[model samples]
Target: MEEAEDDLALLVWGQAEQRAAHGDPSFVRGLAAQLAGRHAAALEQARDYERQLAHVIRILALTPGRDSLTQLLRLLEDTPPAGTHPGLRTSFIASLLAEHQLVPDLVATVFDRREWEKLDELRACLFHELLLRGADTGTRGPLRDWTHVRPGWHPLAWLPAHRRDFEADARFPSRSVRGSASGVSSQLPATGRLDPPTPRPSQPSALRDVATVDVHETIVAAPQAGGWGACGAWVFLLDHALTPEQVPALLPTLPMACVAGLGPTDRFEVAARPMDEIWHLLFETASMGGSHTAGVHGAYGRLWAWRSMAGLSGAPADAGAAEVEQQARQSTWFHFEADAEWFHNDIGSDYGIAALSPDRRRIAVLAATDTD
Candidate 1:
């Protein structure tokens, strides 16, 4: 089956075996473009059968629903498809699938006979309306501050759910509020000062600026005026498991090939144009090392990917409001770049070399690095 033929067609799979190894859809446009006469008619007929019943029946037959364990039990109650024998299937799920968020896990563990015996003493707590009785805990904190009907206005019978607004001299006799036996003139305990509110604490304008996500990272000192159009991060291989705090230092190396991201595809969009020679260096670097070995020091082989960004230049809000409108043509993706090439900020092992154009023109250099 084409579905089961997990051959070498996947790039991830192929490269994975090497490093050990190395390494949408869109609809077609134009009605006339797709309608190719007789072939189109034949396709339409076949699709019509599929859109009606053929595809549905095929899917139903194959699933009978066993792609997942939950579905396996349901299907086995009858007798079904090609994937598993019910007995072994049950054991397999009990081992692997039960650990995650599956309901069967709770059913097997928490409700086991031992657990049931422990909770048996609480039988009276179950199957009953839990009417909480006694002095109200309402006088505590926010509950006391919460505005409610002035107390003693009505009989306690008015506590029924739908019973609203106590009547004056009807539900119960109203007493004087200026001086009542229930400490009417006495104020409830003051939880907080109400003095014109402490002139609201000042905001951290400094931190707010950092909190604002500009999505801007200066890729190089190439000086394209507003900023660089793209940026990426790469880790320089960890000799050991690094903690979260140690991560930002290595984020600056992500190359263009990290991933192509969301939205519509454009023939015009590309990580490297023919003129971008930096791309050549990236491709050569990625391909040269089939399997990773010692990078002089043991520190070199542990490198892993972080994240990448590309597509569309942004303009300063103060100066280029007009130019920002042209950026609608840009897009980015993660994991794989579809039809794009890979490249880093430079070629070779120079710690702080500059990025170059395809012709080797010095467009930008590592002016500085921003860790966070």
Candidate 2:
């Protein structure tokens, strides 16, 4: 593992040097400023570093080796050799570390440094990298097992991604750049459209009844092409009947007035007794204000979700949603959001805690801006 990690580090450093040679010198300077605790200068150089950091993260993510884990942890430690390393390289190493499921470990590192709140940008960069990789950030999911002892919100942790999606909605233009808000399309709306259908709350209700619920379910993500464009969707399959006890865990923090049925294919309706209650219980919170519902996602509709996160810098990841869903099965999912770029044209992006059962059978998908 040590040898492999050394080789991995060399590969990353080599790439960084190559990038630095061709890229702006300010990027490297930004790293030095950050290391020296020069916030203003670091912020000024953020854009230059953004591209380089993103590049390193992608390369490291694709590089296969369990040794990367050891190196990642080592980089977090403020040891002698690492202390002597250049700030740019250190930041790049940190970005690589963010590519995996190590939130608890990373947070612990921050705490150990006694710089919990000071490393907001570092944590932000890591969180953003996790999003780019489609990696489950151990912030709010079942894997998240920390208590909040701080005064304000979770320090250094951003709000839930789904909540950020809604906040971003208020900034988006009602109509998309290519289509109307009504989901009109030149081709078949089912197959393609600029705007796709999204689920919404059927009615409003009280808040006390709304709470996070968990249901375990399988979600299959596949590449989808439609008249609108290319995107993806989660084809969820329930193993057994959903119980009322497991409904709220899957829903958002909004009120649910009705129940809906969603299948693997693009067929959704007001689900029958147990299923309707199950979906309603899970999605009602999410449906209160956002475009969350148990609606069938069309190939075009998936594009809307894709657009929601279009501002995300790195290339779209090929990580399996099914794998993420499996992780949700092992961990818990709750409602959460994050800060995002100001895009007035975003459709939707699913970013939040999933309410999944302990067995991973019932899943409440609290989507960000898009629905799948």
Candidate 3:
């Protein structure tokens, strides 16, 4: 009986692969059902169970039908041990589903079933993938609403509040250029213009006098796209006011008195970036999920990071997004391309942004680097 079962498993997997390759949906659906039945039987008998279950999931991932997805979700919901992290179960399934041609249908079905919380990681992954892939008009409304209603701590919670800005950025041709170590010139808006730096403060503030902001708490609370990384924010009180052209020259001056050293400045090619572009960069970076983890803060991390930067620059803590963005716009913003060496483990992700506050008296540098 064991030998026969093994033969059946091999036959099913071989046929499923062959049919899937040939675009034979009907055959694939039939095989998925067969595997689902085998999964149920294996569960009942407790023999060769895990292998049988993996077969079902593999076939179902390729099927793309609503029924197949439902079955897959049921397996995800019911099979894991009580203490198993939801992310462990959801990551594989989310990755498989993200590639399906019928993503809108799958998303609608998941929403209809009200499985958002139980499958929260899956839902977040789907949303992030959709955004990355450029959600079509039909998909945007529901996705926007999903962000609005999703719990505040959800990684994507920042989407609804900045929908207009995000949509505008999405329309820009440079939006697709992500964290390239070569620098962010390609990601800048078409204008490639920075508002002139705000006039220097009447009285220069001393570095020791600037209020201390807890940047580590703000940036580390969320999971970055490249996996585990280090975040550091510094406040610099400059004797001279900064110009857009001069911001890149300020990197080496940063006091590496702490553990998180300055990033790879020697390798970086820096360029002035508009405030909106920088905001978009922060959102994209924070919203990214690691290879084996979920994006904990999703879109929400942008606000968290922004607020911290604002506090470092002496903006009001309760300032709205517009006010904060305006403040950043008046500052000198620079984006550079280089491995974030401060992380110690480099996985080709290097994101660095520096801003000389509008007052030109204070400079805030925020950098995050990670490995997947």
Question: Per-model C-alpha lDDT, please?
Answer: 0.22, 0.32, 0.52
**Backbone clash numbers for all candidates listed:** 13, 37, 3
The CA root-mean-square deviation of candidate 1, after full C-alpha superposition on the true structure, stands at 29.5
The weakest ten consecutive residues by lDDT in model 1 span: 298-307
Best-fitting candidate, scored by TM-score? 3
Q: What is the lDDT of residue 86 in candidate 2?
A: 24
Which regions in candidate 1 have their CA more than 4 angstroms from the true location?
Answer: 1-36, 54-236, 239-241, 256-372
Q: Can you write out model 3's per-residue Cα lDDT over 1-372, one digit (the tens) per residue?
A: 222567667767677788788898787676667778878986666544544554456567657688888777777667642323322345444544655537667667665436534766566656655554556523456666666566777544433343334334421111111211121222323344332223312232234423254543443333333243555656667787766566654454355332123333234345677666666566445444343333433333344446544553446656665676667667767765442346433433445566778878776666665542
With candidate 2 superimposed using the best TM-score fit, by how many Å does residue 333's alpha carbon deviate from the native?
Answer: 17
Query: Over the stretch 1-372, how does candidate 2's per-residue lDDT look in tens digits?
Result: 122446545644665566688886665554444445544656657755655554443344334354544343343343312222222343334444543336556545533324343443344445433443344444564223222322234322322332222222111112121221322111111321112123433343233232212111112111111112222112133556555344432232233221123212221211112221222222222212233221212211222223222111111234232333233234333332222221112333323323444454444333223432
Q: How do these models rank on TM-score, best leading?
A: 3, 2, 1
TM-score of 3: 0.55
Sort by lDDT, top down from the best: 3, 2, 1
Please give the distance, in angstroms, between residue 67's alpha carbon in candidate 3 and its true position after superposition: 2.4
Q: Over 4 Å off in model 3, which ranges?
A: 1-63, 76-96, 113-125, 136-149, 152-155, 161-213, 219-225, 238-241, 257-269, 275-331, 337-351, 368-372
